[model samples]
Target: MQRGGRVDGATLANLAGRDGGSGWGLKAVRDVHQGHRLITLPSGCHLTYGANDDPRLLALIDKVPSELWGAKLALQLIAQRLQGGESQFASYIAELPKGFPGIPMFFPRTALDMIDYPPCSQQVKKRCKWLYEFSTDVLAKLPGSPEDPFGGVAVDINALGWALAAVSSRAFRTRGPTHPAAMLPLIDMANHTFSPNAEVLPLEGGGGAVGLFARRAIAEGEPLLLSYGKLSNDFLFMDYGFIVEDNPYDTVQLRFDVNLLQAGALVSNVSDALGAPLDLAPRTWQLQLLAELGLVGPAANPELNIGGGGPGAEVLDGRLLAAARVMVARAESEVAGRGVERLCAVDRPLGRDNELAALRTVGGVLAFALSNFVTTLEQDKALLVGQAVAVPQPGGAGERQLQPPASEDEMLAVRFRLEKKKILSRALQRVGALSQAAAGNAELKQTAGSAAAKKGSKPSPATSKGFGSKKP
Candidate 1:
């Protein structure tokens, strides 16, 4: 490699091997201070390009088969490659010997050419088409490098990893201080949370010393929790479909008594408020984020709307989720004078006796309900997205036919799980607002039409009193 001109003492600290000479066992890393940010990547890579000029990197690619590729999977695979892999992936990194004459490390373009498939495979061909599409102009200008497959250089490990996964993937940068090539080793050891520990202090010079700070006061045997990312309740739900029971990240965070459920609800609300729910389609998301954003209606408050819908919806990344949650918490603060109740009316229903009981119940299960509600909210919102499988209302009108028609055969499709009956099915979303319909359909006020209005009749003055349009 180039005469060791990396961070101070990084090379002296460890050989350019994956082990980094410290074989520190994975106990999970947590940040000790709040507002601590460890800069992971300074920038992204050019598609199919790497810093390496080594002919050996390219030589290795000649040995790899370029035939194996799946086009539909190719997009996801490329995204995965960009994000990199888990910390444990260092094992694979360590396997590559340093000072090798050819293929010093995993190469970028080499990895693309290494697809192990037959020449005629449609997937492989599709990926090739994707590369061409990218190279041409689909996503801005792409570079064209038709170098000899045999003598191309090894792709940078980070670039290859990024190709494997996008920078946004949760597993992208989860690795601890395994190699200097990664974020300053010990710095990564401090995990990330939406609310992070103070791991960074301003230094006299330019760069700050990245340290692992404590999120809370430590007692012996407590598993320190470093924030992973600004994971939203909706994103989390989309990811795991419920509160993280088996998640290695959050479960370990719980040792510090971090309440994920409470955080999740706040995430859901703020994401909703920001007019960014799950953007299923790229078109819909572009409209929301890049075009008209926020819940308030357009220009003169003319068109009413809800945020975040469609198939292939874009989820709120961790950074935005974390900040939005803070906004939600502050907005709901009674002292802040906004007068927004933290819970929906149905969640804490009215009535003297019921209210008292509800208070006790809320007090008793605040933590439990927080997680449960966020989980339910996520599932419900996913339904509203309704892009993947959209069918216009089927069956006779008002005859109780399923919306977005589903066949008996479709419902009958069997998925054999070990505990088939134990896992609960996700609840469907209410057509407009799952929140109003959370308890039941009865609570939803039909501002547009009720049974009387549907029958060509006008509603009584009392019934139509306070209904207002929702601006988006």
Candidate 2:
């Protein structure tokens, strides 16, 4: 606290036996009121790429890609770590975790494979590979000259990995987007929670001091928490080395492929008159409409999302919903002149039959995703509780005995996939309900038409309305 830093009613301590335990955390020493300032550190305590003033260090930093800001800061951290007692922040550097066992980059092959979700798994591998190459190919080859930043110290993959993990998990970009990210001393000790009790803010007058304030009243011994972001499990696990239970921000991603939609439509019983599989090949108008929505053409984004948190969150991305509806539409009259916004609204069903087809098609997509997982949601839950579950071997081989996760990494992987499965299952249930309701409504309309014919009255034809319709 001597370096122009202040701590009020809070103390750093080892947070054992708490949620995701065995980490250092800041805890309230006494009752603190809401909006109270709890901690403050002057600009000198902020560690950033610009903190190291050595000409050689700054020159070397310029070699790193601008987008790899984490790596650039990691280089600064490594230089300080090498300085040891000579460094101004030696005490803080020493307190930094020697190894990050929780990060997926450090997980064993078996534990990594347990993640199962390709999007996260592939990213983990890519980062790991880049670290290896950058360490050996770039840092290791630096010339031992006057410009040598590390003073000829051989930086290996292990050292670089440690530095990278430290920066990724703790650094914050408080000084706007244009400024490099900074690591705040003592301020970074706060653990993360979606519902944070405290928050980090800039001190008044903008003198470059960072302050932490209570967002709500804090009881004595309450752990001070800060929200990392509204991130999914993939980000939380990959970057922070932990996952929140029932995270509302979590989403399952799928590529927007017409073939997948075709399979979904077929499985949901959408077919042609000759009993052939439903054709999802977009016609000229449908393609134009999709292109207008940024789902087709060279610049189109194929990524689609589902299962977001909170009551107001959409279960399906609007673009994905619109595409599904447009693809299932067999006639131009069904969707002609309808604004893209109108087609995307969940409340605005095209027709009873059309709505059922669209809902069921999306359901088929989710079902296929769920089938890719080795264990069901129930099985995953059972495994988490220490129950042994049997899983099928590859290639239709006989089932093999699977035991409960033996390591924290493996357990996290299981938890991650489990949440994803829950999201898919929940989405499926919602669409299933919609499909059933639409079918029932269609049946009722058919019954009503039969009654009107028996009464010797011709039933009026239903007029399909598009956006901006006006009555005669």
Candidate 3:
């Protein structure tokens, strides 16, 4: 390469129709063995956030909110792009994508609305709004002024969006979390996969050169792939403009509300002995337990998750499950003095009734959440596969023919929601099994009690109600 970068067994090629049609990727020119270094670029070649030395540009970057670091880097990239041949990294800048069609920030209003998940929708709107305001309120007035960062050249929202997308989709944090990210030229071209074939590592002795090594033996003509992170679809879609099929790291967010829990308890057929409404109000001991688990009180984190974040993670958050179990408990003796860890463990059942109520309550909550989606899981699947399906119209008016996704954004949105539904559905199945087991245990206990009464002998204290405490 012209800029002191080395490519040994790999060559850049147009990899259209592969890896979500990212347009370009690095392919193996020859067989590469495990641990072989594939590519290397010196530190000087990295396009970092703090590399730009212009005082005006630095001042503007300072004014930009720290949370909007992407915008700061976008400013630097735009400045370099405007410089053309005069810029030191002009060739690298020229090779960047002219436009980012895949990014949601560039999606039209109709396409944007297709992203049904509120968490991701809110983020996309916030970034788009910031880009619009910054372009109109600040960057537009920079031309012909002493504080001009782009040398009298105008920077518009479109250009700003392009730079922001480029940075978000390509940049990597080579240094560490606290430092600004850097855009590695050829290294960034490798497409992402959950199971990566190659990995990036710094050269030995801190020489400032970064190297990419093969994680396993590679055949000739294999495209190099890298793992971005254990990110959920919410992040993968928003930051990288693509979604993974059945990503193991995906999660569905829910707020831990007592009202929702109460509704779930009611749906699960749980009732009070006193014939009172199922308020699900936490008792003092239960409140203390929830607070200790960090699910309620001053330091509580009410955000709950339905799916796991990575391999071997619980389908439901431990703290959330523990809180639900504690909330449904009828008496202090049912869960008194039990540590949070034991309550959080799925294998540790407090009692047959308590376990059934907890599992059924969780199932009810999942069902309620699923009901909020605009389309059914079956309809989503049919639409994703380009099948023409008839869906019921609102208010029982009539059925309407649902068409396939019209654009990539719509397809991704459908895919996002579909995965979330899958997670919820899987979790529901699990809870159903647990609930059945708990019911079976309860029936066995009841049969034993009936037999004990028939014998006219008192039931063993150990087997009687409120008998013993779980070992801490």
Candidate 4:
């Protein structure tokens, strides 16, 4: 071990051999710490869990209404499956109708996911860093963990959510795109302390792995802390519920991990099924669909079952995040159209043939798509960052590649690749939106065509290009 001490658990069973720790990268944990992790035995190194690890964690998981033993078992299986290799089991349990009990009072998020933690307090981030340092410093001084079959990080969460907080996350192994260096479940468990005490930034490569660090002085017994990364200001707001920012502001961290993306898809399906019959317009329904899709809220995330189905690929396929792009563009188009219509209503002149003019149609499809697609571009770029960090697929998987590893050399590589991908995907996304533009043009043609169809009718040859791209 290090030099200071180690803490062992005395309660419940030690599921994962009552070992030091049992998430993904157990090897790294050992290598990094040299066997002196300083923490106690968790009854088991579960890949995922149901409600709690043991009865002591809270009242009783057995008593909880849901049948979750199966899931808990699955978590253990994933751990065993990926044991010695880089694999993590991400899971959760949310029974509280409102919110669970407090988390700080328990083991801390050091073992959970970051998105699960509070809004990521500035102080927590600082304190968490100090705690991690403390954990390392105490390595030698502490005694070996008590050999309790049921003693591990699994059962510390209290009846009130305060005892422990778990963050849902994607699995990472050293071999995959989410290498151990980049995906630190250990750090992830700690959550975002916000004080900058601990940070895990991408390594020197333009798109390589990440580097974990301590932001402050550490103690001898405190838990090691980590971050969830910078998020958009609205964070997961657009996914979970209805909270839109007047002015777009970004959070220092990303709101959801790849896990949320999956959850959102499920939620959207459910919400649309239930809410679709309410007789709402597509736009109104589309906004509601965002929450179902997990773009709005925090709790919308689901428990990640290891081996059940790994975090879906990072949506590198422009098509995967396409609907989001289309929706955002459409919204923007609507607004722009309104403005144009105001101008048009004032009897603006369009005296020439084959000439472009503003539209009077307020909710024209093309205008909406343009706006929606424009907003989605930022989300797409941001998501690209997440996708870049996601599991890599084959080169032939799609039209583009994830930005190459984030390296100094790779940055240029990434820049070039990104430029090409942007051109391709943007053009693709734009072309996809063109259907709406076609509709808008047709509306104009109908109005203008009516005039032309009557007299001096030389049907203006339909143009294939956009008003924006035309050489004025």
Candidate 5:
């Protein structure tokens, strides 16, 4: 077996417990101080692209292109595992998890539909199909395939899928000869957490070596956890087969259609013109203007936090608000026969009228987005309230079941939608208040204008004071 760098004091050891199920995980043998070096894997220990040079393996590797480097490595692991006890990776393969939990990629379409996380499910389905094809069409067709010369057993698609999942979750991107991803024996064992207690850093001398250090003091026997970077539950489920509760980085994607914006502009600005259908050309022109301003497009998949944030902050992305404000002005100009330049200017101050218009426009935009998820939100809430079942399958009499009110993924989906609702609810409330306040301002201006016209002079100073003092 190939061993890497020497770990000081044997502070780290592999242990099996509920923490990692049947899979082995790294644990602290003794209370370790913050910044303590726990484990290190030298360059030679890493399993990287083109690491195995056997003629059969090379023939398979040559069939794979560099862009699919990770797939090649996964295939290599599968090939090695087929060799069983004779394989160089026998020890490593033995330590891997027996099965992955809640991995959508491995789940059938019916199972994926049960999870209801469409983005992750769709991506997994697409990738799984590719992996299956590569296994059946390419790798299985190579020389010595019929006899299974590498091992006594044939390498099949199911084996490839398992190896692929393992590699996807555990391998680290390394600066190897090909500078591709590799599996580091001890380093990959550290589990992930949002608040990680330890971190992996590249070795100073650069022998493909990496050191694990505690971010804070850890009690003896505590599991060594690492941050997989700040990732959302969607990414966590799709790539790692896990979810983090209350993940601060979690966000839902919201894409605005230009047609929706135009429709909303017409409703907000020209609703009273019962006889005339509004001209859509102005709204379309404004959308082009928004595009030129670098505000809206395919790439502008703005994220909406389930939690609350300011207008220009996280909740309603700033660029989205900017585009809405411009669209509202364009709507007004179409009705008032005026220019749309002032509203488009970046440096101009947002006067009271513009603020009111922008608020109404942005409120409509948020409402449209919130409407798309209403069914999902309701379904999630219903699931959270339902009772859990605990019966085994009819044929599997011996198996135990822990059916809950909802699965972990189901609970997470509910929580995420709840937060999004709260944010949109708050945004909508603000929009209503501002729109009302804008109406009051307009009324007050009209009343003052009448008084001034009757007296043939500007409004009295006392009236001006009352205008500024009126409550919104």
Candidate 6:
């Protein structure tokens, strides 16, 4: 690795080895200022797609389909590792971790079933299943048996998983390079942090090296960090075998069945302003509403806030508000074709009550979904304080030993849940208030109507009629 910029006394080593280094990491010998170059990986030293000159590897790659291109690269890496000193990637391969810890592929069935989040667990299962399929269908078709190093055996699912994880965590999508994605040597050693102190920039001009420059000042002996972009915990765990505690960018997805919503619309008294009930099926109606708001399918995940204008604002999200409007309009029998702008207007011509009612319904739904996941903060705090699980003793002993403190995974899980819980709880309370305001307004109107009816029914002292009746 060559120093790309004015890097002063920086070296690559197992920075995390003391704490159980997962692999190689970079460290600073002296204090490095912001913008100081840490390392540069020369072009020839890196591995990119379609760069392997080996005829056998290229032939194998040609046989593999484009969709499974990543798998082909993984197989190539394994083949080179088997080649030892003769392989071009010997040094880089040696530095990589033996196996990626916490990758779902390596997880046992029992462990897989233990994942708290259903989405994450489902994803893990899907990935593992796909990998197994590729191994059987694709690898089995290749020449030679399991004993052959350069042939089929090199594509073992387990070995390929290691390569997959390494490439995923380390590779960069470079523009000026021959391959779509390339793996840099020293540049890949930097660990990920949400807030990074350095950035990996592709060197401008036609040169091959990519520069790792300090984004900010780094104290001596501090490990350099890079951002892997903002990612949620579920994705992070699935892809990187780890989760960030209380990630600000994290959110719990709430999925709704369009069919169910449509079914409700059919039987419900809710209708548009014309007083006609929804003509379409509940699912179709939901789609129409979402289509109006441009939230068809995957676009449905809206950033929820306690109160929202936009993402960081105090007002609620516009998309959510629009959805609430549609629900209210349908319930109140409001007119069709009213867009989001009209619905969200402060002085909307009509359907004000409908908006409030919608807010209540939507808020209730969100709260219920949020409450189902994660333990209460109090419960989490108690667990963190001191929770123990009994484990069977060795040699078939009857007694069970209590292990102090929860596992790291459990701790991280609770912490992540606690953060999400806070957001959900706050938003629930706001929605509740909005609902109550709507209810209170309806009650006030009912009381006023009653008083007016009573006054109208009362006799006008029988004065005018008495004039004619008394005279007769």
TM-scores, each model vs. reference = 0.29, 0.89, 0.88, 0.22, 0.69, 0.70
lDDT of 3 by residue, 363-389 (tens): 777776776666778889998999877
Scored against the true structure, residue 328 in model 6 reaches a CA lDDT of: 45
| Model 1: how far residue 242 lies from native, Å | 11
lDDT value, residue 359 of candidate 5: 59
Instruction: Give the clashing pairs for model 5.
Output: none
Q: What is candidate 3's local distance difference test score? A: 0.75
lDDT of 2 by residue, 1-472 (tens): 7678998988898788463556689899999999999998888888886744888888877777776677788989999999989987899999898888779989999889888777777778778887888887778887586777888888889998999899988988898767888899888989888789999999987868889999999999989889987888777888778877777888777767666676566567665434455667667888888887787899987777776665457676677767777777766666667888887886566776567667877887777677777888999999999999998998989999888999988998899889988888888887877777777774432211000011123222212100011110
Residue pairs clashing, model 2: none
Error of 6 at 312 (Å): 3.5
10 residues in a row with least lDDT, candidate 3 = 446-455
List where candidate 5 sits over 4 angstroms from the true fold.
8-25, 51-70, 108-110, 143-153, 176-178, 262-285, 293-313, 331-361, 374-379, 385-472
Identify the leading candidate in terms of TM-score.
2
lDDT of residue 372 for candidate 2: 78
Winning candidate number (lDDT): 2
Tens-place lDDT digits, model 5, residues 298-415: 6543332332232243444455455555544423343132233544432332444555555555665556555544233454455567744333444667644433334554554455
- Where does model 3 exceed 4 Å of error? 18-22, 274-277, 388-401, 442-472
Point out the higher-scoring one by TM-score: 1 or 3. Answer: 3
Worst 10 residues of 4 by lDDT: 463-472
TM-score of model 2 relative to the true fold? 0.89
Error of 1 at 331 (Å): 30
> lDDT at 165 for candidate 6?
77
